[model samples]
Target: MTLLPKNPSRLIREDDRDSAVERLREAYAEGHLTHEELDGRLGRALTARTRRELGAALASLPEERAGTTSTIATAAGRIRRRGAWRVPRSLKVASAFGRVYLDLSRAVIEYPVVDIELRLGTGRAKITVPRDAIVDVEDLRTGWKDTLYKTRRRSRPGGPKIRISGIMGFGRLKIRHARR
Candidate 1:
């Protein structure tokens, strides 16, 4: 029996031309298509200036069956700070105070801050801080690739503070401090 519906839905919509190309590239890189097949399909996709052209190229690709869904749980509270805060996991902290805490054991973080504390656990997490924010990172677990970046010549003395802690497999923490 055919698992997919005889009349399957279109993968790429006419309005999603650019996105279709991007998705095609990702599929090709993931070995979903053979090199020869990818080369021909990629050529067609690149030359597709019109939405219809792009859609046709996308429709020609092989379909991928859906995998198991990923369950993501999250919790957030107020941190007496003036900035955008994002944490991709369940967390509990005194929001009344000017402190941000993240449990990167199962999620990635992307936000604007000056300080950062990273604790990764068996997964990859990425954080983006404001350029003027000072960064302080503490890696508690090893075997996880952790990277920290600072924007040159941008940061105020009293900027936001970031603190992260967890066990990570492959994670990244970035700090973009304010422009000087």
Candidate 2:
């Protein structure tokens, strides 16, 4: 039996939804959408399970965030991102049956806010953010275990903010602040 979903085509992947959300955020930032409009569309997008629904949620938005988002996917192997990698405004990281480790301690993050969407099927994801960075996991949805994170240090006044979302199915996510 394969780890891949039997009917993968019918379900909208979490990364696609994340891209749309990021686009919506960009539109909001550029003054294309009002707060009410963004909220409504975001609610719709998050609950949408099909391509049609997702498209409808993003119906009136402009084109994508000018390619500010990138995706890294692995169906059966590990995906690791670390060191001086240039972190985009929005990143979609997905793993179907393996581990994912993303370390932003030494990464070059240009944006004030970085969005990380993680979709794990049957493995763990370890994310290490800079000590001064702030993390927000309000949008993440777990299919099995809850994410493990403990805030032991205070974030800087203007440190970068990381927004994490997506689905974790039968997997665990451990997020921590990097040690200086």
Candidate 3:
């Protein structure tokens, strides 16, 4: 008799798991989820081995329901956020062989600080922000091609700050200021 392999769960990366946890925290902070729910989902997220399991863990969260605004680009498609769109405090992007563009020049930003969690696989992400807003990409992890940020001046007072953090593989992340 031949031995067959069991149905193994689709393994998830540590960074992906961490991102899910962060989303949970944001949900809790926004008063969308209680402490008990956060704890339970966090626990489930930490132990989740498959993407489906992780997705299930966060399926019922308010942020994922209708609370936050986010964009995702996959396969060979392109995702863009421009004009007067609402900017959520927490933004998550997952791109594989796709392009993600975020133009925040005239966006309606509700939070003073925005956190962007990105996962890039052989893809690219370009972000355009207001000239006065601050941009931070220290938390980003790129491969051979390092992420780039082009700005005119340093962060000013009362300006919105964008925090970009996450993992990248064979991709590029560029941050530019919108043209006047």
lDDT of 2 by residue, 25-112 (tens): 7677667899999999999999888888899988977664346799999899989988766688999998889999999998767689
State the lDDT at 117 in candidate 2. Answer: 94
Candidate closer to the true structure by TM-score (higher is better), 2 or 3 = 2
Backbone clash pairs for candidate 2 read none
Each prediction's Cα lDDT score?
A: 0.44, 0.87, 0.81
Order the numbered candidates by lDDT, best leading. 2, 3, 1
Ranking of candidates on TM-score, top first: 2, 3, 1
Evaluation by lDDT, superior candidate among 1 and 2 = 2
lDDT, candidate 1, 54-143, per-residue tens: 666777566643432222332333222222223422232222212233333222233343223233333334444444445555633445
Tens-digit lDDT track for model 3 on 53-111? 89988997654445665756577788888876667888988877788888988776668
Q: Give residue 48's lDDT in candidate 2 (0 to 100).
A: 85
Who is ahead in lDDT, 2 or 3?
2
TM-scores, each model vs. reference? 0.34, 0.62, 0.59
Off by over 4 Å in 2: 1-66
Q: Whole-model lDDT, candidate 1? A: 0.44
Model 1 Cα RMSD, Å? 14.6
Report the error of model 3 at residue 13, Å: 49
